[model samples]
Target: MILISLIFMNVFAITVSLLIIVADKVMSNYGSCKIIINDDKEFEVNGGTSLLRVLFERKYFIPSACGGKGTCGYCKLKVTDGGGPALPTEKLILSPREMSSGMRMACQLKVKNDLKIEIPSEYLEIQEYIGEISVSESVTSDINRIRIRLTDPKTIKYKPGQYVQIKVVTDEGTDFRAYSMASNPNRTDEIELNVKRIPDGIGSTYIHSLKVGDPIEFSGPYGDFYLQKTHRKIVCVAGGVGLAPLKSIVQYWKDNERHRRIELYYGARTIKDLYDHEFFEELARENENFLYIPGLSDPDEKWTGETGFIHQILERKMTEGENSEAYLCGPPIMIDAVMGVLDKGSISDDRIWFDKF
Candidate 1:
């Protein structure tokens, strides 16, 4: 009697396990879904995948600095129909006006059925490029200045201060990382990037390990952080690797002979952290309208230049009002501090363009 009872319980458990496996196979299938983009282009994709993933897989490159994590708020799109309502995670990033206008984070929106999405026409022009590493040199202890020459296209046209996305494949999966172009815009055949090593950062690690002649895949020419056409005096602030885009802008100005009065305040923790100082100093010597100021927050006794936080020094030096436009790129805390300084000087939000990393 005991043996028969044990046998019955074992059979029942086996039956329950089998049922669960069958149920998963049936429920996990979400068939094909249609994605209508910009009302003209259409794609058939498998359902139950994030909209960002689908677009990326299809090579419709979107600017996602955080790679679909929804933190950067860079991958917003307008969904006219069939996208359902916004998720809770999206609410944290989207403004009320944006939400009312059908804006949604593509990373958080799942493709459940046929959907219509509106993306910017400029994004439609973005293309993937194949490039080979031409040079990889260390600018600082942790920062590497990498230059890549386009192989397939042989050329790329992008405005100064714009950035590109580097795709790195690892054992875990593929990841995309964005880096500003440090090379001059006039150089169409090659582009340069300033990569700073982060603690256990997958993208930086991969980039640092790259050797000359290594093949690289990337999509580019994104971001509105480029230098605007303004006669206003320019005040540029950069910290650490944030100087990448600023370098491009300054280089462009040098090449074009733009004589607009410009003042650059670059900050680093110590003298050792500073890179490309000599280049800017030479520019200042050559161009009467350009001024380069390098500040060290924690300088040693050998340091003689400006000391302390950069924002404080900028506030002391900058002339307030609508006559000047400010461009800032740095960590969030530094950006906030600089913004406060700019606000106190009566620089309106519109004239203050910043990229917070």
Candidate 2:
């Protein structure tokens, strides 16, 4: 009786597997379709694939921080026609105005037929670059500063504060993670990234395990989170490795000798986490316009300087509405706190910029 039951179960499982296979053969066969990008470029791709995957496969990489899970809301494109209805996921991330303007999340929009989508002109210029790992040194116990030298193009032109997406292959599949470039922008042959090892994070683990001379491929110069062209006093706020892009911006300013008064407020849990304070301190010493303020949330008894939250320190130090523009990069909570402080200080929202990771 037991053998008969086991046989019946096996038969049922086999039948279900066969049905799934047949369904896939019929349902997943979308044949060939045309993808018209920005009304200028066109490509033939197989239908029934996510627009994000199709674009990535064709080397037209989109900035997707959540690897096409539709969480980051970074892979948005204007679908003028033939994209079908927007998915619930897309609606969640997109504003009502954005939806009315035909913007949809590329990751959720499956290409069931010929589609017309418009991407940014800058995105069209983004290309994959091959590089070799030149340096991978630990900045802190958990954070590693990786420097890579371009091997193929030998040079990459990018604005300061832009980020690149590093590709990593794992047992599950390929994953891409974005990291801001920390190196001086004047050096076009190489780029630097500061990666904090997150527990059980596939991309960070793979990157941390890489050795010198290891090959790496990444696509980049993405994100609108860069310093605006202004002579106003620049108030830069960073927490932890959020300093990466700010470092690039500051280096660019120093390298070009841009005479802008800049005040940097860096926040960390303790003094040990303030890895690059000395670099900024030296800059402050050399340039009267550049001021470096490092604040510790939790300081030891021997430690001195600023204590408590960094946003509080910023509020105490900065004058309200002094024709200054603010740039912030940090955790969402910290960004919110800082924004509140900036608002109270009469800094308009238009003058405030932030990147929340």
Which of the numbered candidates is closest to the native, going by highest TM-score?
2
Which residue runs of candidate 2 sit more than 4 Å off their true CA positions? 1-13
lDDT of 2 by residue, 1-357 (tens): 999999999999999999999998899888999999888999999898899999999989889988888899999999999977778888899999999999999999988899999988889899999999999999988989999999988899988889999999888878898999988889999999999999998889989998999999999889888888887888899989899999998998897746888888999998888888889989889898888899999999977789889899998887646688998999999999999999998889999888888
Candidate 1 structure quality by residue, lDDT tens digits, 1-357: 999999999999999999999997777667899999988999899888899999988988889988788899999999999977789999999999999999999989988889999999899888899999999999999999999999978999998889999998799889988999999999999999999999899899999999999999999989999888878888899988999999998898787737678889999999989999999989899888898889999999999999888998788777655698888999999999999999998889999888888
Q: How far is candidate 2 from the true structure (C-alpha RMSD, Å)?
A: 1.8
Error of 1 at 309 (Å): 0.9
Where is the poorest 10-residue window by lDDT in model 2?
315-324
- Each model's total of backbone clashes: 0, 0
- What lDDT score is found at residue 75 in candidate 2? 95
Q: Which candidate is the best by lDDT?
A: 1
In model 1, where is the ten-residue run with the lowest total lDDT? Answer: 313-322
